[model samples]
Target: MQVRLEQVTKTFAGSKNTQATAVKELDVTIASGKLVGLLGPSGCGKSTTLFMIAGIHDVSEGHIYFGDHDVTALPSDKRGVGIVFQNYALYPHLTVWDNIAFPLLNAKEMKKRLKQRFAELSPPMANFKAYIQRLVEEAAKLVELTAYLDRKPAELSGGQQQRVAIARAIVKNPSILLLDEPLSNLDARLRVQTRDEIKRIQKQTGITTVFVTHDQDEALSICDEVIILKDGVLQQQGPPQEVYDHPANQFVAEFLGSPQINLVGGSIKANKLYLGNEEWFALPESLSDQPVNIGVRYENIRPDRENRKQAFEATVTSIARTGGTSTVQVRLADGQPMRLHRDSDDVLQEGDRVRLYARPRTVYIFNAEGEKILQC
Candidate 1:
């Protein structure tokens, strides 16, 4: 289903008679049958947004819609949204078939009794049995749990149990599926395996899904679009590659990268950029001669052995080799530390002075207030 949120906000009473806003005026639209990720650090309100969308938490202000239906005031069970949590929430004593059939049974039983009470309805009770059986079988096959139909939750591995939880949710055939850090409990290898499986299943089922996670790599790898939050506010939202390539602000630029982007303090005098008491590069005419932070990726920097331009002389303080590539920690002339990646055959020893040059286009300039300033 296509989900829409209009100025949604949630607040909770905090200690010392203050109020904490969990989600602040968030407005977003999730297209039908797409996997969208809510990514941010802990306490950034990703979980709160997911809960609001699932109708588990009430919105303090604004509205939510599923297609043309306004479901902002609907209760959790009435919203037709399925949620799978990190804990899986599987019953250890119940077999896979029972677990998957539980929701269908409850829904059918409720509908059956309601139909029985209506005097105008003379339909036979036998008609519902076939429908329920077909739904259960389809759900089991969707999650690939048909072979383990009779197995209990305890008899299955972590990944298998998670699939059971998914099957249970899918049996209801919810219009939207909410996943809250579902892969956090799995091991490294299992996490990767399950992540790929989730992508495959999502494609096959074509259900609109909202996945919440604090792991940037996980979100970037699987999600078609990503919404980043900071301090309960929407910081950035865009395609994964677009956001990674052009961050809206410093927080976003710093949060999305693996090794973290490097920031060096520098001043713009006249038209020249100065760093470490040395003139580096010429700034664009629109920069207006102000102090700025230069952001550069580790891989964009190259260590020079000769004929370096605007090089900051540094000594190798430490080296870390991780198979194919190595990270070299260098101490600048100003005593600041910076990390650079190298794949050169000639390795530099500790305490060896070397010159480093950064590519011009790879440099990102941020003003004093931490907002990115793009060079035209």
Candidate 2:
């Protein structure tokens, strides 16, 4: 199902008779059978947005359409969306098979809804047991949990338990799947492996999915399109790399990149962009002279001794090495700190003074109000 939100707003009544908007007018469309990520920091309304789509939270204004059907007033259970909570929410006493089939057994309301949705394919009430058993087995196989069908939640690993939770969500053949921070409980190594599994399952099932996560790497790695939010407002929505490469504003540019993008304080004077009181780059003669934030990505920064005349000087302060890559942190001549990712084999002492240069065409400029002035 294609999920679309049109000017969907969510508000909460706060203390002292005031109101706080958890999600502002959000207009977004998730294509059929696509996995999309709602990404942002804590208290950014990402989870609230997911809840609104799940029909758990009623919108303050506007409507939600599930492939042209207005499901704005539908109850969560009636919306045909399966929600997997952050903690996985598996029952400790139940075996893997039972846990997956639990939703089916207790789905009194779902039976009525599903019968109406698929009237021609609906089986008789007496055949419901066989139907549910088939669904449980199919879901278990889909998530590769058939081998551990009889194992309890405690017997399985964190990743395995997560897969069982996913199986339970899909057993009902939901119109859309809603996962809220489902990978946050796993270990680092397992998190990576499980995210890949989630992506694989999504592609195999071809079920439209909305995944909520605060981790940028998780979103960028698995999602087709990532929607970034800030303070209840939509910042940007596009393919992961597109949003990363070309951010809409300073917040997105800084939030999307690892180690964050370096924002050097700059001033425009007499058609010259000056950094740390030194003329850094040339600006247009017609542009007004004002303050600007120069954004330089880590990958764009490189050690350049030959370009001393135009390079910025900085002293190596620290280095973090992992695998074949190293992250180097340095303090500029003006005492501003900067960080960059480079080859792990770079032979440089912590106190060594080096000249740094950024790819001129990749540099980004933002105005004092945090709007993008130039992005190349």
Candidate 3:
């Protein structure tokens, strides 16, 4: 289902006689049958938006729509939405079969209401029963849980239990599926395994899914589109790669990367870009003489041994080797820190003075207010 949040807002009455806004005039759209991510820091309203869409929390203002249906006023049971919680929310006493069948039984009342809504166009009850059974079987197979049908959630591993929960949610064939940090409880290896499993299931089932996560890697890896929020306000929304490559603002640039983008003090003077006391490159004609911040990704900055042009002379402050790559932290002449990603074999000793050059195209320019001024 195509899900849209139109100017939605939510607030909580604080104990100090003030209102705290959980979501601030947020607007987003998820295309039908696609996985979209709501990514942000803790207390940034990502979960609140998901809750609102799932009908678990009422919107303080504005509306929500699933396709053409105005579901803003609907109750959780009436919304035809399925949700997977961080803890999985499965019953320990119930077997996997009962858990997966729970939604189907609960959906009977919903089906009655839906029948009332579309009595003239609705299919017969016999067909609906067959349809629900097929959906349950298909959902269980999608998550590879058919073999564990008789096992209780307590008897399953964390990953298997999670798959059972996913199967339960999907068995109802909800128009929109809301997942709130579903992978947070799994081990590192299982998290990776389940992440791919969720993506594969979404693709094959063509179910519209809204994933809420604070992990940037999780959002970037599995989502087709991403909506970023900060301080309860919408910051940016677009395709995952587009948002990462061309962050709308500095917050996004800093939040979306692993090693984080390096922000160095720079200036545009007489149509030239200067870092510290040396001129790095000639500035574009549109960029006048002004103070600016130069943003460069870790991988884009390379340690140069020969060339000095477009380079920063810095002392290596620290080195972190993580099996596949090493991150070298460098302190510039002005005391600003920057990082470079290199192979594990390409090691550098601390206190060694090195020259680093950043790819021109990978560099970003931000104004005083931290909004991106130049994407390239």
> Best by TM-score, which number?
2
Number of clashes recorded per candidate: 0, 0, 0
Worst 10 residues of 3 by lDDT: 113-122
Give the TM-score ranking, best first: 2, 3, 1
Count of clashes in candidate 3? 0
| Model 2: lDDT of residue 170 | 92
lDDT of each: 0.84, 0.88, 0.86
Error of 2 at 109 (Å): 2.7
Candidate 3 Cα outliers beyond 4 Å, as residue runs: 111-135, 305-308, 344-347
Task: Select the stronger candidate by lDDT from 2 and 3.
Answer: 2
Model 3 RMSD vs true structure: 2.8
Candidate 3 CA-lDDT value: 0.86
Assess candidate 1 and give its TM-score to the true structure. Answer: 0.90
> Cα RMSD (Å) between model 1 and the true structure?
3.6
lDDT of 1 by residue, 1-376 (tens): 9999999999999999999999999989999999999999999999999999998899999999999899999988888888899899998888898888787676754455434444343553356666566667898898888999999998998998988888888777789999999999999888888888888889999999999999998899999899999988888888999988888888888898878888777777787887756788886564677887777778877787576676678889998889877888887888778888876765788898989988676777777677666541
- What order do candidates take by lDDT, descending? 2, 3, 1
lDDT (Cα, tens digit) per residue for candidate 2, span 213-268:
99999999999999999988899999999999888999899998887998888877
